[model samples]
Target: MVMCKDVVENIIGYIDAELDDKTLEELEKHLDECPECQVFVRTYRKMLELTGKLRERTFVTPEIRERLKQLLKSKLKPN
Candidate 1:
């Protein structure tokens, strides 16, 4: 079963459409039932779009991506 954390961990790949077929299918199914995740995904997409229009483009390496995932997971965690 795909959990919220799974969504967060895989979000980068999900947005890039780089996930394997099975993972993508599972993530989409979870997204369909989870309003919070849907909102998160939309907001993330908008952030990416805004950033993309900037003069300097940030190249995200695997290390940076891992850090981003940790940052996002921290933000999403309940107090």
Candidate 2:
């Protein structure tokens, strides 16, 4: 079983499906025994779901994208 601290630290990676099988299994086991971690996981998952829904909408206009691109290019250029 994994410790609560480790589980909390890696919870974001787990939610993103970025963990290997061994790590994911360990996290699952920790969640099984820790109610607080379980609640944390549920809340995190809900937040991700909400964010994903919001991301489906187009909030950035094309003019904003061009300005952002120009800003990034200026920032990336060597002095």
Candidate 3:
């Protein structure tokens, strides 16, 4: 079984489906008995949900992409 601390750190990757099978299994086993990890997982999932909603709301406009590109280019330019 993985330690609670490691599971907490990997919670985001797990929720994002970025974890390998072994890591996922460890996290799952830990979450099974650990309420704190379960809550962390729930909160992480809710954050992802909110982020998706925010992205849908903000990125539907072409202006945001253009503005982001402009900002990046400005930041990347030599002073």
Q: Using TM-score as the measure, which candidate wins?
A: 1
TM-score of each: 0.66, 0.58, 0.58
Question: Best-fitting candidate, measured by lDDT?
Answer: 1
Give one digit per residue, the lDDT tens place, for model 3 in 1-79.
5878988788668767999998888878888999988887788788878888875564446888889999999999999
CA RMSD of all predictions: 18.1, 7.5, 8.0
Please list the residue runs of candidate 1 whose C-alpha ends up more than 4 Å from where it truly belongs after superposition: 56-79
lDDT of candidates 1 onward, in order: 0.94, 0.88, 0.83
Q: Residue-wise lDDT of candidate 1 within 1-79, one digit each (tens)?
A: 8988999999999988999999999999999999999999999999998988985767898899999999999999999
Clash count of each predicted structure: 0, 0, 0
9-62 per-residue lDDT for model 2 (tens digits) = 997788779999999998888888999988888888898889989868998999
lDDT of 1: 0.94
Better of 2 and 3 by TM-score: 3
lDDT of 3 at 31: 84
